[model samples]
Target: MALPVAMLGPTVAQAQGWPTAANPDEVFLYPEESEDPVLLYPDDNSSSAPSSTPPLPNSPNIQPTSVRSLQLIGGEVLTEAIAQAFYRTQLGRPADPARLERIAFAIDQWYLDNGYSLSQVSGWMIDAEGVLTVEVVEPEVNQITIRYIDNEGRALDDEGNPIEGRTRERFLRRELQLQSGAVFNQNDVIQDIQSLMALEIFENATVAVDVDEESRETPVVDVVYNLQERLSRSFQASGGVSTELGLFAGVTYRDGNFNGRGESLRFGTQVGSRGLVFSTEFTSPYRDSRPERLGYTIRAFRRTGRSVTFSDEVRLANGDDARERHFGGGGSVMRPIGDWDAELGLNYSRVSIRDDSGDLAPTDELGNDLTLDDSGIDDLLTLEFAVTQDQRVNPSNPNDGSVLTLSTEQSIPVGNGNIVMNRLRADYAEYVPVNLFNTGRRQNPEVVAFNVQAGTVLGDLPPYEAFDLGGGNSVRGYGRGDVGSGRRFFLATAEYRFPVTGPLGAVLFTDFASDLGSGSEVPGDPAGVRDKPGTGLGYGAGLRIGSPLGLIRADFGVNDQGDNQFFFGFGQRF
Candidate 1:
């Protein structure tokens, strides 16, 4: 009878239009009705291989303890004070049992964290002798064996070691932070893996630690590094178009790790509608067992349809289009001091130029015609000294760190009197990370980048040697060399980059630049220079796509004068 009454009440309520759409917010559940929450662990084990030994227990943060006569049984692995530091424990005082227990657990946890995952504290007890005994099962590393796996083409010998004749062990040895007979440190292992992968010769690197069966009492583990080598030679070709260069194609060949030594040889050529270029470079990171870098580069190029002038009036009249040819070669030697490099270099270039139409008499950008005392051909020899510090994590795309470079060059006349100048240039870039959402991660999701460059020529400056500030490489919203051309200039850029997906990113950037040269000048005056038209401003957004070749970059920019321009390149603008 009671059940029938309850059922009739629901029917009565429904008949009275009491039933309507349900509101999820009005629902509530008791804790007893809910299932237990599941705990999740991040997979440190490799996804490609079978799971590693079961994960270690997490160390709990414990309060400090004051104990008297603390004794660790396995004292050979660590000093007494060092073990106490790990637990933040003190001696010669009254100690709480609970706190002492935490200290004992923390000591074992420390060993596990340091790559002795199998180690433990077998016993933690206060004996009748009035001493606290902590038995530690610390394992030592007995050997380190480096294995080069998946290396074919006679690169390795039968014992799985790098062939002595074909391979230079020092090339691989220098990258390792771990050594034989050292305690196993997970941090060092991780860093060693990264360092090995950074080398161009290795496609992949891995490390595995295993216990030695024959040496169980001492409990020694062998650290093994497995490396996979990449092809010794590679070639790449690419075609691109920009508002400045119009259309261009380039091809490059590289033997970056020749003869298993960290030496690089590269040759590249580019042909475009406005210019043609050929260049070759060779670098040896270590010279004759010394920590010095030596490199040489040779280049030949020709360019046209680009104006290097300051006055718009003169540019409009003369069209400012000049055909120029240049051939140059340079050698540099650098000594590494800590993380910075101090370098000295010498360069010589033979430069010749003519008007697009004919060989006109020399004239300043302000239209003062004069005789330069000879043809426009000039052979110049330059001595340059530079200091550079690059701490960026990645060359193509950097999320943190800074790079600073300062260089000075003195150009001495060799062929004609047209080459006598002192040049100075300074450049700096910094990257700062941004995480507005407070994501609890070590790596940032976005970056704010800044760049600044200033250059000046103090002595007699020829038109070809003048600085041109514009185009995709400079102010961005203008065509090549469209901005002020002058003996002195300063440029600044700021960028904000955010990741969109894996290997895909976006950037918002702004550029500001100015030149220092007055357009009113005497043509024959050694200080003859034209005033920069005005300051240049460019703002844009760009897309960054990561590829095997490199980062593919594209930007759409707008100038202060409302001109729109587009740029395409292979890496970051700075």
Candidate 2:
């Protein structure tokens, strides 16, 4: 039994006319083309012609209105209209067919260069009159070839040569010195080539891609890179001045290639009235090839300045000729531990103070004629551990972001009394964007920023041995060494800076400070009563001039006590 036409519609549609259950002659696997004409059912009845006339289905005069003409071309017709229609949805503009075809060819070339040798595009006619469809076929990559030359055009070893594993695809996709995934932008590739050459690692680097025209699948990318080793030594020197510290100069020398092993050595020095200092540093970055660094620092300096004081009363007999000679050396090892940087170091320092007065006397015993050689040397051996988190935009021009530094230090006296000075210090400097009205550039140059610094000395010492907070760098309205003996001090300073054209600038700054004295006295004064606390507020303006030697500055400051002082130095106050 044969199935009804309705039941066989799907199978016949696929097979074009093959039956499901048929006799031997009707059960052919493939059907041959039929010579009979196509038949159509008309909507209206029509009269039949004479005997000489042909059947309605075969008559040329009986044309079917629904039947349309179809044309089959050997190749895909990617017309300009279709190309523009396809790209307009994405690019918001009609694209020329010629340009899109070129882009398609470039994309195909890119795929082939990456080892996709069998990729292709197939087209299908969607409508008999107009529409067309295109489909991309990406085949699995089979093989990739790289044509390259080393610095000497010599065959490279896997271990010794720098360009041994450099390939065209890697250079294009991964190693290119530009951002990737730019949608086959030719300018990006060109810029990458330029950037790579600018590194000075290669004498010449040229890249080009060619595609197989017949298959349009396999592509051959040609890369030529000639490398030249660069010199591995650099030296730099900078000099500047500030009113607090005069005539500062720095020199840095680096040996990029030490022992032909990519080690670096740096040495520098800074000299000024505050201190004539020298420093030497050495670093080995590739100690383990993981960017682990081992470094050592040695610094020596002699600075002349009175002690910072927080007292409201100015002792007339206080020593004005005070100075400090410091010599320190430390070695540190730094490694990346998670997102933070960890450093461990051991330091040794000898601090010597030269003061005329040996010790404090009673109010009645205070005499101007007394001058004692109270100069003594204190030796401190410290073990320090520090962790830092640096998240700054534009580290060179740190106009934004914050940096946190936390450190702990323990001082062990080797020869003197069995006393240890335990110190905890934390510093945070944040750059916050100010409102347009509050910006220094738009206001008077006398405004200063607020700086907060807190630290404690946890050990046995005289009240004078504790932290003091009144000075030029501390409370600007107070005298130097006037504030004394407190484990804690809080200060706020507002500074304003402005430029006056041609390397000339000015700064106006004011600060407030309060002291928390230890309330204990030296061996002589046994009352152990805290010293009188004082508040200081001061403002000053300074002129900055840029020169070859650095910025030369002069500032005149007046405190709340109507004391006017002049300072000559170089560099910014901060």
Highest TM-score among the candidates is held by which one?
Answer: 1
Q: Which ten residues in a row have the lowest lDDT in candidate 1?
A: 35-44
Each model's lDDT comes to 0.60, 0.43
lDDT of 1 by residue, 60-92 (tens): 232243355666776655567765554333355
Q: Worst ten-residue run, lDDT, model 2? A: 31-40
RMSD of each: 15.7, 20.1
The residue-level lDDT of candidate 1 at 406 comes to 91
Model 1 residue 282 distance off true place after TM-score fit, in angstroms: 1.0
- How would you encode candidate 2's per-residue C-alpha lDDT over 1-574 as one tens digit per residue? 1222222223322232311232222211111122211111131122221111112232233222221222222212333443333333223223223323332433233333333333333322223232323344432222223334554454464676644432224433343522321222234345555554433223335443322223545222222323333344667888898432476777767654444443455666666665556656565431222343453333333333343331323333352333344567777777656676677778876555434332322221233111111324556678888887766432222334666777877877664333477767666555544444443331123232344556666774433345555556665545564434455555566665566665576767776665444424232221122243445566788787755344576777777777766667655444
- Candidate 1: where are CA atoms >4 Å away? 1-77, 80-138, 141-170, 197-215, 218-252, 258-262, 269-277, 286-320, 355-373, 418-420, 436-445, 516-532
Q: In model 1, what is the error at residue 334, expressed in angstroms?
A: 1.7
Candidate 2: list runs displaced more than 4 Å: 1-290, 294-296, 300-323, 335-339, 355-375, 392-397, 435-449, 462-465, 519-534, 543-556, 567-571
